[model samples]
Target: NLGSPDERPALYRERSPVEHAANLDCPLLVVHGVNDRRVPVGQARLYRDRLRGLGYEAGEDGDFEYVELGAEGHASSDIDQKIRLFRVLGDFLDRRLG
Candidate 1:
């Protein structure tokens, strides 16, 4: 009862318990592999976008973050990229969760 008819149930499930706000108290960060095949990076991005729109840091109303590693897939097999990835992740955590 909350959207255009074109929306399928499964697709809408993630948006359930809908939230619409411009500011929230919490924050979040998400690191994802661009080449992920199982859940697809799109889904994670979708979640981030939704949250961002609502004002949660993890969402639009807040400080939500999404990191996509290129040529890394689900796991960073490349040593160089892996090291950089860890450094970025570490920085993100230190700055956000520190």
Candidate 2:
């Protein structure tokens, strides 16, 4: 790790995905587990909201999309949930790269 953001402000800013939102040229799909303790869902929500503020849209065929899974922690425990997440990711990539 580069160290905590408080200790390395410049490096943290450079590494933060949210800081480069304006430069995004491709579609984005942000997925998060609401029950996540490590990196809370709010962080993902903030990123998606920021993207939307910068003129990104949210939809299956839009420039940006977000998915929140309930009852899921840092990682989902259910195999079905994992499958769904992968499917969504695959579809997102296909639509973007096709």
Candidate 1 local lDDT, residue 53: 67
**Pairing residues by index, what is the TM-score of model 1?**
0.62
Query: In angstroms, how far off is 78's CA in candidate 1?
Result: 1.1
- Summed backbone clashes in each candidate are 13, 0
Query: In model 1, which regions exceed 4 Å deviation?
Result: 1-25, 57-62
Residue-level lDDT tens digits of model 2 in 1-98:
77887899999789777899998897777889899999988888888888889988889888887999878889887999899889989988888888
Root-mean-square deviation (CA) per prediction:
6.4, 1.9
Each prediction's whole-model lDDT (CA): 0.65, 0.86
TM-score of each predicted structure versus truth = 0.62, 0.83
List clashing residue pairs in candidate 2: none
Residue ranges of candidate 2 with Cα displaced over 4 Å = 94-98
Candidate 1 structure quality by residue, lDDT tens digits, 1-98: 66653777655655543333234344555778888886578877776677666645542334766677776577767899889888877877677677
